[model samples]
Target: MSKTLIVYGSTTGNTESVSDDIAKILEKNGHSVEIQDAADISVDGLADQFDTVLLGCSTWGEDEIELQDDFIPLFENLEQAALKGKKVAVFGCGDSSYEYFCGAVDVIEEKAGELGAVLLGESLKIDGDPEPEEVSAWTESIMTKM
Candidate 1:
């Protein structure tokens, strides 16, 4: 069984709901999972001891890409998490109408890749409300790949 950690930042609870859904699915798939709010964690050693990490954050701002409030610090100092060689996945919520939909997931995936984290799959970009089926399907795909 793989051990996975889910960290998320949500302003209006969309991303949070998605994170919870993912955790449930992963658990149902027989993986050990831990979920944390980004506000409660620091970048240092954030990915340590976990076989995989799933990061989720909502995108804010109209023109510029603004990561969720609590995720800013983590994004700023992602290298400190020491994720080299670790498996990772990214997901987030955003409005499709926005120019940069789910931009935070892109940024995090890019940075984690730069820091040598192996991406498990393509990210989940939720436009508007999150649906459990979508989250479950995405997570099941990740479990297969993991």
Candidate 2:
């Protein structure tokens, strides 16, 4: 089974809740899963620990990466050499009314690619709140890839 890390940055717990649900689904499917607060995870040591790295964040301040004030620094310090060949996924919560729906997920996707990580599945975007069907589909897609 592939090991997956679900890291999330949530200001009001929305993204955290979604990340937890995704982790539960992954674990239920017999995959080893680690759920961490994005701020608490070490970008340096993450490369060797898991086969898949999933990131979740909510949009803040006009499509800018949320809670990125901290996570971005960690991500900036990350070298492409550290993440080469790793599989990755991104999921996030955002307001669809915003011009850039799921902008946070997009940021994670772009950065993950720059680090040479392969996307495990399509990025999932939840509007305001994540629906059960959406989460299930996203979880299933990632499991299928694994």
The best candidate in terms of TM-score = 1
Candidate 1 TM-score over all chains jointly: 0.97
Q: What is the TM-score of each candidate against the true structure?
A: 0.97, 0.89
Cα lDDT, all candidates? 0.92, 0.78
Question: Candidate 2, residues 1-146: lDDT per residue as tens digits?
Answer: 88888878887788889888998899888999988887787776676778888888787666454534445655566573256788888888888887877776887788788878888878998898779888988889888877
Q: Report the alpha-carbon TM-score of model 2 versus the true structure.
A: 0.89
- Model 2 lDDT-worst window of ten: 63-72
In the range 47-116, model 1's lDDT, one tens digit per residue, is 8989999999999888899999999999999999989999999999999998898989899999999999
Q: Model 2, stretches more than 4 Å misplaced? A: 63-70
Candidate 1 residue runs with Cα over 4 Å from true position: none
Tell me which residue pairs clash in candidate 1.
none
